[model samples]
Every structure is written in C-alpha cells, then in structure tokens.
Target: MRLKPVPVEIEKGKINVDIDLEEGKTPFIVVYCQGEAKITFLPEHGETKVVTHQGKVKRVKFDEGEDF
Candidate 1:
C-alpha cells in the first residue's frame, strides 16, 4: 500500500491531521517527532488524532561522562 503525506496544522502545540480515505479499508502511516508525543487513530470513523507534548528533555549533555 502506498501512503500519502497529509497536511497538518499545529495549534496550541497539538497537531491535527485530516485524511480522506477511499472506499474500502486502508492503512496509512503517521510520523511523529521526538520528545513526548501522543497519537490516536480512528480508521473506522475515517479520522486520526495526534497530540504532542513539549517541555520534556530526553537527554542531557555531560562533560566528563562516557557517551553510550
């Protein structure tokens, strides 16, 4: 199956995607950035939901520490 990139808008730090699916059921791909991200998909209702969170740090830089 071929996946198409859908246009998204970020409002209040949340991303919303609107997709139009053809007749019959199909699967689509969803991309998310790092940090803290939440996702919700509703294929039966022909809609997908995505939520992202900020202000969270994943890694910290150390001067005398070994990088793994």
Candidate 2:
C-alpha cells in the first residue's frame, strides 16, 4: 500500500503527507521526521506500530476529539 502524508501539527513542527491506498483498505496514520517515525490507527481500536529508520520509533495514541 502507498502511504500518503497528511498535514499534521506536531509538538515542534508540521508534517505533510499524501497516501495512496486501495479502497476498502484500512486507514492508518504515519508521522515521520528525519529518520524517526510513528504510526497510529484512526481510533484507539487497534494497536499502533512504531518504526525507526535508524534509531527508534514512538507510538502515540490520540482521541477522536483531537482529530480534525
């Protein structure tokens, strides 16, 4: 699946993404900067996956009210 980056506001900076996924496919969110990254689902319904390009990845959970 092609992951697109949407506009996101982080603690210090902003993130922009454009993802291309097939229809019926689950929706996911990925935040990355430099080499570190974080992936979270739409809701807290599923597990979040953390991945690092060379160092470490952090998983964060957000509520629906925090979304746009």
Candidate 3:
C-alpha cells in the first residue's frame, strides 16, 4: 500500500512538525515548495532542531524567504 505525500507550506522560522508514518519508501513533503528551506530535521529521533533558511543552499539554515 502507498499514500500520497501531503503538500505543506513551512514558514520561515521555528515550526513544529509532529506526524507519524510507516517505515518504508516515503515521499518528501518539501519538494512541492520551491527555494532553499533550511530545515533542521533529524529523522533519527524526530527531535526539534530549529534553524533558519539562508540564501545559499549551504546556508539554507537561515530564516530568510528566498529560493537558493
């Protein structure tokens, strides 16, 4: 069985993402949105690592709304 990836818009800054899913092939929810999103997501434990999206793809961890 398979499920469609839900489309979501993450604002620039700290946003809490608490959702559960089965362990297997999963689609990314950020691809729908354009630009460099500095998401501090640690899939290991689902811990909250807040970071901002910077202009550069390398610095995508800064809170500045712009496509890297």
Worst 10 residues of 2 by lDDT: 58-67
Ranking by TM-score: 2, 1, 3
Q: TM-score for all predictions?
A: 0.28, 0.29, 0.19
Worst 10 residues of 1 by lDDT: 57-66
1-68 per-residue lDDT for model 1 (tens digits) = 23334444455555555655554445444554542333233254333433334743333222233345
What lDDT does candidate 3 reach at residue 19?
47
Give the top-scoring candidate (lDDT).
2
**25 Cα displacement, candidate 1 (Å):** 5.2
Candidate achieving higher TM-score, 1 or 2: 2
TM-score of 1: 0.28
Error of 2 at 66 (Å): 14
**Candidate 3 TM-score, true structure as reference:** 0.19
Which of 1 and 2 is ahead in lDDT?
Answer: 2
Cα lDDT tens digits, model 3, 1-68, are 12224434456443344445565424233322343322232333233323335632222222324344
Q: Residues 6-47, candidate 2: write the lDDT tens digits.
A: 556667675655444554446776767654444444643444
| Candidate 3 lDDT trough over 10 residues, lowest sum | 55-64
